[model samples]
Every structure is written in structure tokens, then in C-alpha cells.
Target: MKSKHLILIFLLIVSAKSRAQTNHQTIEVAQVDSKKNNCVEIPSTFSHEILSESKSLNALKSKKIRRVELIYTRYKENADFDQNQLNEDRMSRLNQLLPKLQIDKPEIVWIEQIGATTSTDAKNYFHGFRIYTDVAPVARTYQRTHLNDLANPAVDFLIDNTIGGTFSHPSGTQIHIPANAVIYDNGKPVFGKYTISYSEYRNAAEILFSGLPMEFKDKTGSYLFNSAGMYEIRGTKDGQTLALQKDLSIDFNCTKNEAGVNFYEMNDQTGEWNLLKSDLFSANNPNETPSAKPEIMSANSEQRIKRGVAPDNYETEGSSKVYQQLNLVYGLISSKFGVYNCDQIFRIANKTIISPKYLDVSSKKPIKNQNMICLIDKDVNASFSFGVKQITCNSQGENIFLLFTEDGEIYALKSEKDKRVNLNQKEPEFLMENITNKVKTSDDLKSYLNI
Candidate 1:
């Protein structure tokens, strides 16, 4: 009886151990499957409608996310496309919706996976983000790491809300506000004195430093803007924001009187430029320099003038009628106070897409950690930010490429007029000349780009 009981007990113990091993294997497989399931696939093409329906974005809203891993696959065939720009655009869209969803911003980790040279499955091309709640967050590197250190300071003006008046910048830009035009965000009319902070970006260096998106999209296609000038205006009363109850007249001053330019207002949240109005350019009289003497309604107006609010480079030759004629004044009536641009749509006639390998002049090795790559079309007054692998530009336009490093270094590549790229080579090589020490200021950069 004792031997029989021992045998039964031994069998029971073996059964229990067997069951434990099986359960352990099952749990391991389940964890692997859960990780795979956490990766939500997103569409290859990005749009506002598609973004609204993103599963990953919805997960962010519903769950307590510890971290997010954005996975992008780079295919060999589309190697020349800018993957970083696409990711940035998607992130921008996500950032815009996060506030509305009342979700805290998660730490996003960008991961670039190399796809097979010949991918047969369509799923291989899909990009996505993996959400984690249980796991600890890990450090990750991002590709879109451009630093915007240069900024033009805003010129502040104190204006009476009861009696509105015109304020002018030394750059000849004017803003004409009307009485009782200021209102708070809640539609209450603001009383007493308010301050208007205004800034202007007139050149390539200013535009680049301002970090404004020059690209515009419409139903037809994407286009670049040949900016005549750009301005930012904001109203504040005792540190609280104020808005315009009525349209404020703007006389945007520029050196060039380019025709067919339109007014555009930038969406601050999305960084998208919207077309506001047309017929913006008005020929100014040769004898009149609007910016030469600004009319302000302030007790210290004379002190402001004496301080030389006008930029020295923009000083009009009071003696030369030709110089005054070159000073173009464009008109705009806007009810919104924000960043506005006077720009002409530049349609590339002959588009050339190139993936030029950037090399440092000193070491002759590949440049790493490039913060931003800018291509300025000197002929059309347009600028382009480069993608990770490819840059698209007008084949015949006079172009200059500027590559900014992470450490504030600059490298430049000037293309010869009418022959921007060599079509014969599969991968073109651009030997970038270091211009970091040369460009000390915005004016210096403008001179270097010859814009």
C-alpha cells in the first residue's frame, strides 16, 4: 500500500511540473504577440482626414502612454525622398490634436527601419507608432533636429485702445488700427492702453531664421512661395492677449514691386499658410517714402524716432527718386493679428530631384547631424527645406544650398545659373564649403546667399 501511494504521489508531482512549463511557454508567446499588436499601422500618405482616424493617435487619447515609438521604413526605390519631413508633418498634426484630446504629450522615439530592396508585401511599406504603458521609457534619437537660434526682435508700441492710430516700423511697414478695435478672446472690448509687438522678415536669412514654412498646398498640388515680405503682429494689454474687433490696414513695405503677389496668413497651430486675399501690391509714389518718417501717437514718439527705430540698411535715400520708387508698399486689411506673408506662387517648370551626398570641406567625409538644409531660389525669392535624402528644386533656377550644422556651423553649395544638377549621375556629390565663420549676422547670410 505504501509503494502504491508513493507512485501516485510521484505521478501527481510530475503532472504539476509539466503543467507549469506549458503555462510558462504560453505566457512568453502571449507577450511577444502583445508587442506585435501594440504597433499600430498608419497610412503612407498623410492628410487631415486620415490623421483624424489614426488608431495610434486614438490610443494616445484613450490610454496612459508612457512612451511612443514612431517606426518608419525606408525603401530602396524611394530612397531619395525626404522621410524626416514626412515624419515632422505627421508629428505636427498629432501635436495639434493632442491638446483637444486632453492627452499629455508622450515621449516620442523615432525609429527608421531599413526595408528590403524588393519588398513584395504591401504591409512592409506601412509606417506606424508603438505605444507603451508598462515598460520604462528609453532614450531615442530624432532625425528632424533643426535649431532656430536666430530671431528678429519685435518692436513694441504702446497704443491707446480708445483712440487707435497708425504705427510704423523702420522697415516702412505700417499698421493702421481703428478706435475700439481691441477685444479679448472672450469677445469683451478691451479698454485702456495696449501694446502692439511687430516684426518683419524681408530677406532669405530673416525667413530662414524665423523658421516659417514657405511651402503651400492647395487642391491642385504643393507649391513654394516667393515671399516679398513677411510680418508678425500681436496685441497685448498688461500681458494678456488682445484681438482685433475690426480689420486693421497694413501697408507692407518691400524693396521689390513684384506683381501678382497675394497675401497669406499662417495658421499658428498647424504651421500651414492660408491664402487670405489678392491684389496686394500698390505702386507707391516716387517722391513718397512712407517708412522714412513714421507717425506715432505717443508722448515719447520723438524719443522713439531719435533712437533710430528704422534699420540702417533700409534707410531711404531722401535724395534719390529712383530709390524711393523701388520701395514698394503692399496693402492688406486683416482682422486677424498674426504672422502674414506677401508672396507669389512659384510653379517649378522643370523640377529636378537629386540626392546629393553632403561632404565636409575640411574632412571630406560625409556630414553628420545636419540640423537643417535650405535651398534658396534667388530668382523667384523662394526657399526650400531639404528632406533626409532628396531635394527638389527648379532645374533652371539660380539656387544656393545652405546646410546648417548642430553646432551653428554653416556649409554652402552654390549651383551655377541654369544648371543646378547633373542628371547623368545616379548619386551626385556636393562638396560643401564651410561658411560658418563668414556669416555672423542676418545681413552677412543674405550677402553670402546673394539674396
Candidate 2:
């Protein structure tokens, strides 16, 4: 009887250890109401180990989730690790996985907490994720119409997926896809006809209007992108998105032939740009034989012309040609379907962070949340979007500041040539001239700023 009792105790201990190892971390999904105290927690057996097949996710799929707040807990045992980087990695993994489980992209808010470290057990120290779903959606703060108008339209092309081919943009940018290179998200092969949508942001107007983020953040600090050219390409079939099983080639034409330009791709979920590869520019040949390639060139020249840094017809003599032979091309190879940019980092020296108050010219009243502020450094092909926040700018660089109102109004702060603003002062009020009637389009805005 004693031996049988000992065996029973041993079995119970083993079973408890097995359960602890299997369920190392818990993931809870809670529904949040308007009142902070009214959070109703749903019973969740969802653990990190079974995230892919969680019944908690199924419960969320039926409801309309406006925002998702991810509350993550880290134990003191991992205090040495970089919390910000770990947060980003976990958030990125969740963002990628949640969408696959039929959860649409919602506004994701991350909250970090430190867990108690009284127990030295590894399972106790394991990080956990608690998700709070907000059903009530908030109204958009900015004017989407103005942003949409400024954005460049995608150039679509239908391609045969079975036998891949090269497609050229009117700007002379060529996308070369290999045969049988397309696949669905689940690694399933895709066949038949697929549509490829491509968009390019070559110049200041294109970059500014596209509303695509050019800021790259690293461990050191945030840096702006001095782009040679930026392009977004995506593949889809019938309404489903497609991915590249292999790398596709891009013969990117650009006006600038600068060396040391690296390729970067933006994260669809986080809006973060990750550096992929670097390429050198080949020597320019005006009479060189053109491949069925596309052009990313002329933007550098066009920008220079617009900024009065270069003479008119620097690369052309009033030619109606899209692909100018005089421009340089950077051969880029990408394995993903998303936004790609060939750019160099523009480090802002002596940076100043200022929360300037915006005032209307006509009424002389302070404007808040009703306008979007943009600071453009045309020399470096860098633009910063300051939407009711502390604006950071290079104290030495000649930056152009423009305010875009909600009601389609435009205003500009007069920047004198080589006159630098005193970075020491805080809360400087900028009186801007309302140039709404003069600027009809992005081109007009660019011209007006140049003048």
C-alpha cells in the first residue's frame, strides 16, 4: 500500500510538470467598454503554444474590433534585454499572425508591464500577452481626401503567373518576375492571371503627396531618407494577395547616380523600413542600349530644377522621352511584394524639437488638429510630417515648412535663403501666409515653395 501511494504521488508530480511545460505563457483576450472599469474578460485557454489554433481568436473574428491594445509582461529575469526591441519583435510577430487568422488590421497599442520575479522557475518568468479589444472606433483626425489626391496612382499590369515575364512602367522601371515564382500566404502555389500594381515616388512632390513614411528609426535615433527613387509593387489574383517565392529583379532608373544607395522595404504593419541590400550605380551612358527596362531617373534632375539648383533641361532638351538614356539605373533584386526605396540616410545635425503653434492668417486664431505640418529639406530629398506634434528639424539645413488645413487650405512660413532659425528658442509662433488659392495641386505647391 505504501509503494502504491508513492507511485501515485510520482505520477501526479510528473503530470503537473508536463502541464506547466506545455502551457508556458498565457494569452488573454478581453473586451473593453467605454468605461475604464467595465472590461469583461472572456475565459481563455489560449496559450502562446497554441496561438495558431486559439479559440480566443475565433471569438474575436465574429466581433468588430476597432483597436487592439496588447499588454505584454516581462519578468525581472530578462531585465538585461532591450525592452523596446523585444516589444517590437513580439508586436511584429503578432501583427503578422493575427491578420492570417482573419483579423483585419486595427490600431495596435502596446503596453509593457514588469512581472514579479519572486519565483526562480523558468515558467514563471515567461512573458505573456493580454489583448484588449475596443469595439468603438474613433473618427479619423486628418483629411484623407487631400492625402489621396497627393498620392500617385498605381500602374496596374496583368501577368501570366505560370510563365513569368517582365513588365515595364511608363517611367522606364522594369519588374522582372521569374517563372512559377508566385505563392499564396500559406506557401500554396498560385497560377493563372495575376495583377501587379506599381507606384513610384521619384521627386519631392511625389514623395510628399504619397504620404508614405520616409523616416527610418534605429537604436541610435531617427533618420530621414534621401531617396534616389521609391516604388511600391504588389501582386494579387482575384481578390487574394500573392507573394514572391523567389526574388524579382528591378532595373530602377534614377536621375541621380550617387554611390552607396541601399535598398529598404517598409513593414506593412509597423510602417518601419528595414534595410535589405546595397547596390552601386553603373556608369552613365547616354547612347547605351535600353533594355525593356523602366525609368526611375530624371527625378533627381527634376528636383534640382524645381529647387533652382540645376539649370533647366539638365538631362534633356525639351524631349518628351520618359526614359532618358542620360540617366543612371540601379539594378535592385527584391523577394517581397511591398514598398521598396533606394535611399541613403540623411542624418540631421543639431536637431531641434519644437512644438510650434499654428495660426490662421485670415482670422489670426490658433489652429489645432485642423491642419497638418510638413517640413521639407529639398536638398537631401527628405520630408518630415509633423501632425500636431513636436517638429524636429536640422538647424543648419534650409527647411521648407508648410501647413495643410483640413478644409483644403495651404499655408507656408517664409524661409529666407541661408537664414537659420535659432534652435535655442522654444514655442516659437510661426505666422504663415495662406496660399490656398494659389496652389491647386502638388505641382503648384512645389512651384510656390521654390519661388
Question: C-alpha displacement of 406 in model 1, angstroms?
Answer: 3.6
Quote each prediction's TM-score: 0.63, 0.59
**Off by more than 4 A, model 2:** 1-146, 184-191, 219-221, 282-327, 405-409, 418-423, 435-441
Most lDDT-accurate candidate:
1
Once fitted onto the true fold, the runs of candidate 1 whose alpha carbons sit more than 4 angstroms away are 1-126, 129-149, 186-191, 237-239, 281-300, 303-331, 418-426
Q: Rate the local accuracy (lDDT) of all candidates.
A: 0.62, 0.59
Location of the lowest summed lDDT over 10 successive residues in candidate 1: 22-31
Q: What's the lDDT for residue 128 in model 2?
A: 30
Candidate 1, pairs of clashing residues = none
Residue-wise C-alpha lDDT for candidate 2, range 16-121, written one tens digit per residue: 6444321122322211112222122222111232233345666665655444454444444444655444444455455455564234555455533332334343
